[model samples]
Every structure is written in C-alpha cells, then in structure tokens.
Target chain A: MPYMDKRNAARLVNDYADMIMRIGLMYLKQTYDAEDICQEVFIKLMSAELTFEDREHEKAWIIRTTINTCKDRKKLAFYRYWSGEPKEELVSGDDFTGNDLLEEIKKLAKWQRVAIYLYYYEEYSTAEIAMLTGRTKSSVQKDLSRGRKFLKNILESEYGKDYGFEKGGADYAE
Target chain B: MQNREKIKKAFSGVHFSEMEKSLMTDRISEASLFAKERTGKNNMKMKRWQRVAMIVAGVLVLGGTVGAAAGTDMIRSWSNSFSDFKTAGKISQKASELGMNSFPDEIAGFEYSGGNTVHNTGEDEAGNSTGDWDELEAEYKNEDGKSIYISQSPVVEGKDDQQHTDEVVIDGTTVLYDCDEYLFLPPDMEGKTDQKLLDREASDDHFFISYGSDEPETKFFKNASFVIGDIRYLIFSYDEVSEDELISVVRELIQK
Candidate 1:
C-alpha cells in the first residue's frame, strides 16, 4: 500500500516516537528494551498497509502495534531473568517531577500500570483502555479503582499524615 | 485532591530530553530507509500509468496541504508553545465567578520562586482558546535544599485538562498531570551554592534515564497539580521530592 510518501513516513515516526517509547517504557521499565520495541513498532508501521480513517485511527494503530511488540519482547527467555537495570543517561538528565509516584506506578502489576497509565495519564476512556490492554471494560474499571486504592495507601504510608493523605471522597467511577 | 488525580499528575508531567529525542530521530531515519525499500518493492507492482496518475493526484493534494499532513503535524509539534499573558495584580471578575482561592507565599517549607510568566488561558478540546482563566505562582524551598513551585488559578474545564476524569471527588475536586508543562527556576535561585550542588548531582551520571519523545518537552525538575476550593494549583519540585511531598506542600498552603 502506498500509505504515505517518504516525508510523510518520517513525520509519522517523528510525531509518535515519544508516545511509543513512553508506552514501551511504562510496560518494560527497562529503557533499552523499550527503545528497541519503539524502533520495531515504527519499522512495523513502515511495512504495514495501514490506511487510517482519521488521526485517531492512525494513533490507535501505532499504540496497538507498540503494545503487541512489547508483549512479544517480554516473552523472550532473556526477559525471564531480566534485572530491572536503571539506565544512567535518563537519571542524569534528571527532568520531570513526581518521580516517587512514577516509581509507585512502576511497582504496580503490569496490567494495572498499563490500564492506569492509559486511563489517567494518556486520558483514554476506560473502554479505550480496555481495548488497548485486551481486557474487559469492567476489568479495566476495576483495575483503576484497585490501583488507586493501592497507590493511595502507598503514598499515605510513604509521605505520612504531615501531607494529609486521606482517601479522597472515594468515588471510583471513571 | 483525590489520590487518583495525584497519580494522574505525577505520570503526566514526565519530560523527555533533547538528547533522547535525537536518538529517536536517528532510529526513525534508519527505520524509514528500510520501510522505503519494502514500500518501493510494493510500488513496482503498479503499472506505470497508474503510478503517474497517483503522482498527479498527490501533487494536487499537496497544493491544498492535505497530502502534507506529516509536514503539518511536524510543524504543529514545535508551534505548541505556551502563550504569554499580561499581568494584573487584582483578581479578575471571572476568578470571583469561579470562586478561586488565593495561595500563601510559603508551601510546605519552600518560599516563593518565580521564572516563567503566569498563564491565564488554556486550550479547549477543539483547540480553541478559552479566556479569563488567570494564574498566580510562587516558589517555596525548605532548609534541606528541596524546593516547590506552585501556580494557582481557576479550573479551566475541558481546556487541556484531558487527564481529568471522574476520578475527581464529589466536591468537583480533581488533579491534573501536566506532562507537557515545564518548571523554570526563579530569578533568585541562580548562583546559590546549594542549587549549584543540586545541578551537579543531576548531571553526575547517577542514573541516566530518557523518555523517547519526538517533542523536546523536558525540564530539569518534576511537577504536579491539583484543584481545591475552585482553584487549580500547579506545583514543581526539585531534588528527589516525592509526589506525596509535593501534595503535602500544596495541602499545607491551601489549608492555610
């Protein structure tokens, strides 16, 4: 399929490189593996005959491919004994805030983190998150609720009452 | 603010550095060549006349900017800079209407720090500009050298607050994760001994981490936000500050 010209293809990669890498990092935690998966996703996009009805369709396709590629990489024998190594470059650059919360999110079960990241950070609907993670809508909703409760406790214990860490009205609908 | 909202803010404020972006570009270029080869082979299947007709169609589309969507998307990335606002000391009428809160100079333990101009406008879902949302910001630092910066303003619903969800409490309270916003140091932090030490520590190769984003949207610190009492507060912290710590700082300030 003559999906996009070379310039357009390059633009797609440039526009989405960070998004793919972020999702990969959220999943893998290991930077190298995430980067590799990011590259593979773009390469797959390059080869796939993807026709988009709109930008959302194109973005969904990329994200879905990235998640699938990351899952495949996780299945590798190397991943079984994978030591979550911290890359030196990322820490040194030392940008972004709320690192402790990010650490806590990383500590979560993979499906939960993926669901939470998509649901909260990416601003995807629970239905959309369910589609992305291959889970039921109710399951995604439950993960968000459970994940929120789990994180609230961790944050409360970690920061203590000096910060007023209380369960916020506790309505977990969205 | 709810814990879910804090989690959302914490995750969204992540910034990817320029170095990391460059690496991603390199990888994309490499992938593009391989993609070109495969697509080129596919092109060979088309008859010459068909190829010619497609080229003409593409040319016509390019004239109207439809075919250059990639190019348009690329430009849109860099052009998404924050808009500047004219400063006013008195509260706007809109603030009164929204019942926004006024913030104290000290939060947790950090003092007021200023760098970037206050922003009063946020983008709507349709990418339209919504007006009359004003902001006030201050930076606070404790004796331990850790600092927090905060921006307070009325909640601008559906205006770039996509991270907002029903995770909000019944009181219409929610927190926003500003992954796209950066925190600049106040004019006073420059040349301070402890601040320099923190900068050195940041670059000392303790742990190298980079987010692979095409957009160069990274700064040297971390930040989070929440809305309470009809006011939205944005907080940025440096030197290994926890999200809980940041929230606590905001809690202390807002409670006052």
Candidate 2:
C-alpha cells in the first residue's frame, strides 16, 4: 500500500508546507511562483511511491523535490524571459518586506542560496544537506562558505558592519 | 550565529494562505489522476534482459518523455516487452495503417494547441502483447488558461477485465469515472461543496476543495472515460471545466 493516505498527506502538508514555501521564496524570490512550487511538490509526493527509511528521509525528499521543481520552472523559455528581471511588486508583499539583507541573499546563485537556507534557517547539518541535494558534503560546505563570504562583503559595504571584521563576527562566520 | 539568526528571522514571516492550501490540495488531486494513468507500467515485473532491451530501445527511439523504462511509459498501450525486433516492426506497421486526420481541429470552443500522432506496439497491463495502436492527442486551450485535453486511441484488446467505479448517469448516458480513488470529496467536505459553483459558469480560478480537519481531505476535478465504437476517449481539465462540458464534447465527437 502507498504511504500517502489522506491522513499522511495532510500531516506532511502541515509539517513541510511552510518549509517548502520558504525554500521556494528564497530561490524564486516570488510569492506566486513559490506557492505554485509548493503545491507541485506535494502533488509529486502524492504520486511518488517512495519508501523512506525514516521521517528524516521523507523530509529530505520534500525539500529536494521543492528545489527541483523550482529549477525546472527556471528552465522554461517564458521563465527566462520574465524571471531575468526581478519583479519588485511580485516580491514585495508578505514574502519579502523589503529587507536589505534578504534581498542580498536572493542575489546569490540558487545553489548557494539553498545551502545557506538549509544550514542557517532549517539548521540542517552539511552532511544531511549533501544527502538531500545529492551534492558532495564538501560542495555544500563550499556553498555555505562562499555564501557567507558574499553576504559579509555586501553587508559591510552597505551598513559598514564588518560581519567578519568585527570582534564576535569571526566566531559567527566559523 | 548572529548573522545566521538574523537571516532566519529576516525571512521568517513568509506566509501561505488557507485558500492557497485548498488550491494546492485540488491541483495535487488532479496530478494524482494523471499519475494513475501510468499505474499499468508501474506494476509490470520485467526481467533483467527485458530491462536491458528496454533501455537500449528507449535510447534509440529517443522520444525522451515516453517509454524510458519498462513501466514508466505514459502512452498506456505499449504494454508488451519490446524485446523482439520483428514484433516491434509489426506493431509499427499496424499503427501506420490508421488515418490521423479523423479528429476535429477544435474541440468544443477551445482551440487545439499541441498534439502528437503516434502508433505504438507494446503490452497491456495483463502482460498480453498488443499490436500497433494509433493514438492522437488534442490539447485545447481556453481563454482562461484552462486546457481541455482530449486523447483518442483505439481501444486496447482484452480490456474486458477492467472494472468501473463511481459510474454516473448523465443525460441517460453512463460514463466511468477515471480519476484517482482519493480524488472524490469525502463526507465532511460535501457540505462545503457549493453545488452552484461546481457547474460550468464558475471561473477557472475557482476550485472545489475539502479541508480535512484531522486527516487529509480529498479534492478532485471532473474526469471520465467513455467509449464510442472502437475508439476510447479521455477528457480532463486542470481548471474549473465542468464534467458536462467534457461529456458534451464526447457526445459531439460520437455524433461526428
């Protein structure tokens, strides 16, 4: 029998819907597209007859599916035409509150943004992220490192807050 | 840690609405139906040699999307193991014999968009080998971005064992519901189901959804299969297109 009974799907939705949407928003930077990706992920889950070793495995599948869906949408011709220029109105509502730092993070490459979100926001270990994303552990760590370095430079230039140049900032960088 | 915490909090307030959840459920249900059409391929138990042969042939055919694996083919009629070259040839020849221009350029009021004319020989779900079956798909896009897709193909032989559930009588004609079993709204959502909105007048953006309080709720769009003579017809929509519209299209095709 399939694992995605009505009860199970609802539970999965309740648990991971927010996380999937957040990942989408971080990668796509648009609320409507993020929401669409969130729905597609759940729909993919319903049809994918995957046997997970544990709850952690299932959660990883959800995250990976969300990322893959976003990437596929980006491959489309229309997406290239429209998504090349960030639609400020599309990003401004509830998803983005015009936060300077968050906007800067959106400027990162998709892989870098995903690694940073998983490490800092979701608090997943680098090893866990490697398994989820099918990337080497070193690759995920490298993305995290590069992402932080980029964030540090941007924030220091804008706010004069030497994120790594300050006393406690170096510790946080590690 | 300070920067990390700030990054998390900066984007923490992103919210998904109740309406969004409902719509997601509805779309998921629709996707599940499309997935069910491939259930036959999923259930096939192929041997090692058959798997090897399928991979080689799939690479050569390179349709890319169809028949990549023994059971992953969504074309539905390619049920037989294509391990034999002669059998494959016979199937192709049979498919070549069917006339492709039988379907209308437009279905209902929607205009045809993308279509594929295919003649494929494969096996049925029961492991019975089939000959070349001609298939045509007509995708009609409405002004509202809702697509009305009609796929017409010759009925596969030995389909007598197929069972029908959720049979509904419309205009004295019985049509078999061809969607996922979980798609129908359970009892709890029935009250919330607006009968008026379920009709054809509703906008494409409107969807029928049942919120499951404890468990997951079931949501479905109108989907059904009907047979007119030797041809089998499948009609479905991703939006608020009504079952009546689909059945009417089927009726119109049968009349034609």
Candidate 3:
C-alpha cells in the first residue's frame, strides 16, 4: 500500500503548507521557489517511513527539510548566478512586499533572514534554530542578534525612538 | 513581542493558494503510488557489456582517466559518438551506422527533441581492442512540456536483475514492465546499501533526493524495457503519464 493516502496528504498540506511556504520564502525570497520547496517537502514527507514521537517532532522534521531544500536550491549554479543580479529586478514577483520591515529583512543576509524568521516568527529558541539550521548555538545567537539589531536600526530611523523593538521572551540557551 | 507579531504577519503573506495546495496534495498522492509500486524489488542488474560500455563512455566524457594504471587503451574507435542531433534523418543515419534497422522520430504525442549516440570499444587484458558496442539516448516532448527518454543498445546475454511485474506482446515481442526507484544519495553516502539509503530517506534529513534529475524533480520513475531482436530498449517517463501511453510508444518504436 502507498505510505500516504490522498486524505492523509491533504491533512498534511492543511497543517504544514503555510509554515513550509513561509520558511521557504524567508530563505529563498521568491514565491515560486518557496512553492516548489513546499511541494518537495510534502512529497518527501509522503515517502518517509519514520514515525514521529509527537506533533513537535513532525513539525521539526518538516522545517529542517524545508530549510535544507532551500539551501540546496541556492547552492545550485543557476541560482547562484541568478541571485547575483540586481535585487529589485530579482524579487519583482516576491510575495512579501509593501512592508518596510519585511523589505529590510529581505535585504539581510540569507543566514540572518533565516535566523530572524525562525527565532521571532516561529518562536523557536536559539538552540532550536541552530539545530534546525545545522549551525552552532553561538552562530545562531550571533545571527539573531545581528539580524535583530539591523531591523531595529531600520525601524528606529523610520518611526522614531518610541517604536518598541525589544528582546524576545524565548529562552536562548540549550 | 510586537516584532514577533509583525514578523508573523509579514511572513503569513507567503503561502500557497487553495488551488495550489490541492494540486500539490494530488502530486504527493501520486508519488506515494509510485513508491508503493517500487517496494519489494530486487536490485536492477547491469550487463557486463553495458558496464564496460558505460565505463568507456564515462572515461571519454571525463576527457581522461584520473587514476588507475597507465597504458590502458579502453577506447580504440568511435564514430559520430557523443553527437547530438534533433532531426529524424540524423537519428536514422546514426542507427544505420550502428547497423540498426530503424528508430522512431516521434512516439505518441511527443516529438523527438534531441539525442546522442555513443560508440564504445573494449580492450582485452593484453591491451588489445576486443569488441565494440553502440548505444543511443533520445528525448521526446509533448505539447504539455512533459518528456520521455528512450535509451537503446544491443542486447547482451547476461544475468537480468529486473523483476518484471507485467509483460505484453507487441508484434510477437514480449515487453517487460518494471517500476524503478532510484535513490540519489549525497556524495558522501555513495556505495551504501539500499536499506541504509532507505533508512536515510526515511530520516528527517531526506534532502539528498532532490540533488539529482531536474526534469522529474524527484528521484524515482516508472519505466518499461524490452528486447526487440538484438537490441534492448528502455523508456522512462518522468511525469505522471499513464503506463499505457508508454507501452503505446514502445509499440510505435517496434513497429517502425
């Protein structure tokens, strides 16, 4: 029998498609690439036979696979060459547009964008972000800090010093 | 934090439409069917002549051998090998040169895109050219941009490892049908057993499967192989095309 039936696949898509697409966009910065990564992750999920201990374990697996797939896609020679051009022309079809903070986040380095997205948006700890991204805790901490500081500076310059940009409540240590 | 809320709000804009989600779900289900078909299959065997022919082709493509003993003349003669052609006239000329009867220009709705021919020479232990072989690979594309790849070579009698699930008689020739699953391992995981590879595929880090094959965008495929007279032909369709369509294409090739 097939590992994942249509009903099961539809359930997975309903549960994880949004998260996968968001993570893919944070790393890839393109809607089409994010869509491709989302589809690829679910396809891999269907073929996988590993049983998860809980819902968190399955979510972690999907997040990590999406990140790795995005990294692999960026490593391709075609993407490397394609990304070297002007950013304005490159992200013309990007979905995350018209938001000042999102534009600044998109301008950050790929690692910084990933760290920021996972830390703030997903509410993952620094250690958890490091685990998902295959980086050291200290490295992820640095990325988070640097990314946060960069976004804060942009916000402060745009909307005065009263705009609140503070440390998150998530535990950072392993 | 307000930053968290804003970040979530911004990222939330990036998501698939309902139609895309439904389409993707169907694709996943289809892929599952392919995987189920691949279960409980023995390793596909490579013929000795095919092995030698591939090694020669690999060496030639690499420009020269990197390591191994010197004074190895693996290739003695090659004619019009590794040449790409788009037209049927070119394919027929190459097939005739290889002493083959005929090759199809189009199959089903897919027109012949392009193909390459390879002529390989094998050497005996004494460094003398012993035998020569020829093989060709062709690609066809339909109006929907889907493709079918066909590979042809002379049939060599050897231990066949493919477990044919079904067979059909076309023009008195029995064609074997098999669903093949290829796990494209990372460079570090090469030469591992199939079970180990499957375990890795089932693991959380299963991104290695995407590293190979751009057309299908996946690792596994459904294929049909058959021997007609002295030549063996293998057809691969990367898209979710029907098995009957593939068989019909094979029938066209044999009849041609």
Candidate 4:
C-alpha cells in the first residue's frame, strides 16, 4: 500500500533503496548509473500509482520496479554485459569490488538466480517467492531445489567438500 | 527451523536497512505532493500583468485599503509602499492594526490610500466609496482562497521575477509559496504545450516553466508538480523569439 505520510514513506524508502540499487547493479553492473536506476524505480512506483495489497505486496512492487529499471538500462547503447569471453577485448573491465560472490551467482540462468536470491535473501516461502516474482509455486520450488544444489556445487568447487556440506546444511539445520 | 529461515541464513547480507527505507518513503511523499505539475505542463496560464494586478490587488484588500489603480502609475505604491510613506509612525500604526507580516518592507510593495481606506471609510460613505475604479468592469480574481470577481482591485499576490530565474533569488524570499518543486529549464521548448499558455493577465510578473523531455526514453513520465504557487502559467518554445526578445520579455516580467 502507498504510505500516506512522509515519515512512513521515508522509512520504506530508506530500507529498500539499497536492495533496489543492488538489484539494478546486479543486472547492469554499472556503478555510475546504479543509483539513477534505483531512484527511477521509486519514481515509477509513485507514477504508476502502485499500492501495496499488503506489506508483502509493497515489497514485491519495489523488487519488480528494480528489475524493470535494470531491463530498461540494458536498452541503452553503451551498456552491454561481458560474455565472459576474453578480458583484453572488452571496453572497460573495472570490476566493481565486493561482488565476486554475486558475479558467480549471476552465472545461474535468469529464473534460477531470481528464484535463488529471492528465496535466500528475502527468506520468503516458495509460495511467497512465486507471488513476488509472478511465477508458479511449483516453479519456485523447482528453482529453489536446483539453486541449492548449484550453490552446493559452487562451494565445493571453490573450496572443498567439508566446507560445502558444512555451511550448506547449517543454514537448513538452524 | 522453517525452510525460509534456513534460506535466509544462507544469504544474510541483503537486509533492507532502516535508513534506506526512510529515503524511499520520503521520495514517495514528495512525489505525490506535487505529482500534478507534469500534467499541468500542457495547460495554458494567465499572464504576468494579470497575476501581479491580482496580488497587488489582493494586498490592498488585506491592508484594509479600498480601491487602488493597477497600472504603471501605481507601480511604486504597489511594490514599495513604505518607501513613499514620509511618516514612519503612520506606517507602524497601520502595521499594528493589520498585523501585516514582518517580511522586509523592501521586498513587499505597498498601496496606502493617503489615510483613506475601506477600513477608514465611514459606512455612510456612498457611491464614490471605491475611488476611481468604481466605473471599470470587474473581473474575477483568485483573491482570498475562493475566486471573486471585482471591478475594483483587491489585494492580490504578485511575483516580480516572472520570466526568468537570474532575476529571482534562489530562496525566492518574496514568492508567496515555496518554490523547490519548480525546476526552471533552459529555452528550446516552443510548442510542447499550447499558445494560450503564452498570453495571460495573471500577475505583475510572469514565470514560464519548461518541461524537459525524458532524457533516456525509458523514463516516460516526470513527477514534479506545483502545490504552493499559482496553477496558471505560460509555456512556449524558447526559439520563437530572438535573443533580444527573450531578454526583453524577461525584463518586462521582472519589472527591472
């Protein structure tokens, strides 16, 4: 739902802006324009008259706007993602710091990454993830199950076996 | 533990912080407050003289004065009324009676009736009570909240710097309402709106606001809207006139 007051709106914005920015940055990976996309998404939320059906709906709207803004930025001429082809032939590879883990996760197929992240980062139920991302509950489950396995393999390949299963089940163990 | 909680622990760094949430909320609040400015961009507004004539006229009624001319003859009296007052005591006395705002007199123009005001006029004073303007045709003004039409001038709001920003102070201490939402753009927008936005009988000073196109096409809409100021204004392409004409119109609106 649209917040009626400034204090509430400010509180919501402050909480979500970083998440939105990271979402935009996750897609385009251009730090210069990441903040612009974040601001634009909020403006879109206001312009489109998006209202929260509930607190959960509001959260989902922000995520959706962030994703749309990322897609919009990709339409710009200068913005093209590296194919992981060859580094020397690329324009500028100033790899933004602190995103190595995120980059690895980006290798996952689009739906898998979206399903994986929304589940792990937002702590949403498979049903709730489906609602947020506009996918089917079963699809979220499939993606989540696959995502877990992919992450397990990533940890094993990056480190070793003990570290993979140890941290892996630990999140589920708790 | 629930499956959701388990997944959450696996990825713990993406929590939305309290401060970030606050900023989004603030933007939404501000955006909604004046969300209509962009839409009103296409609507034509009344002109400078019409608006100035209205506010200067509005002040007259507020000050307990009766009727006053709204022409070049009364310009000084309308803007810097105190400067023409020889007796500071009388000015202070009027202030007490009206409790007029304490804004600098230099910024506020005044119109006194040489000791004759509607407040000072006797109730029995008949017919000629409205000074010389009693014979002129009355027009409606947005004076006093609700719109009222009068042949005689009433106290109306005025903006001396109507056409351009260099003439208006960044803080705009003299403007009747706050001006943060008004993003004055450079010349170039000629017919984005209509020609009716050009001609107006609104105020002594006129302001022309231009709407910038969504630079990157993806941003299809703009959000700033006017809440504090007049809703009527002129919008035209800056190219219609030569450099000389732009400055001339701006100067006339600024009354400099």
- The DockQ leader among the candidates is 2
DockQ of each: 0.10, 0.18, 0.18, 0.11
TM-score of chain B of each: 0.38, 0.43, 0.56, 0.19
Per-residue lDDT of B122-157 in model 3, one digit per residue for the tens? Answer: 343344444556667676888998777677777653
TM-score of each: 0.44, 0.56, 0.51, 0.41
**Model 3 TM-score?**
0.51
lDDT for each residue of candidate 1 in B1-256, tens digit (9 for 90 to 100): 5545665666544434555655555434432332123121111111111112222222100000001111111100000011121122222232344465544545566654332223222223332333433344344567787656555555443323133211322234454332222222332333442655456434432211122323433243344556665565666544467666766665575456
Instruction: Give the Cα error of residue A106 in candidate 3, in Å.
Output: 0.6
Among all candidates shown, the one with the greatest lDDT: 3
Task: Give per-residue CA lDDT, model 3, range A1-174, as digits (tens).
Answer: 213446688888888887886676678865555555665576456434468788899889989989887787767544532332123322333444325567778778888898888887788998898898899999998887788777778878876653345654342323
Query: On residues A1-174, what C-alpha lDDT tens digit does candidate 1 reach at each position?
Result: 324434575567557766776687677865555555655665565444468999888888888888887787667544533436445454332334366677777777777777877776667888998887788999987887777767767877777632223334543445
Stronger candidate by DockQ (1 vs 2): 2
Candidates in descending TM-score order: 2, 3, 1, 4
Q: Best candidate, TM-score-wise?
A: 2
Q: What TM-score does structure 2 among the candidates reach?
A: 0.56
Q: List the candidate 1 regions with Cα displacement exceeding 4 Å.
A: A2-5, A80-85, A91-97, A161-171, B1-5, B12-16, B30-256
Candidates 1 and 4, the one with greater DockQ: 4
Model 2 clashing-pair count: 5
Model 1 C-alpha lDDT versus the unseen true structure:
0.48
TM-score (chain A) of candidate 3?
A: 0.81
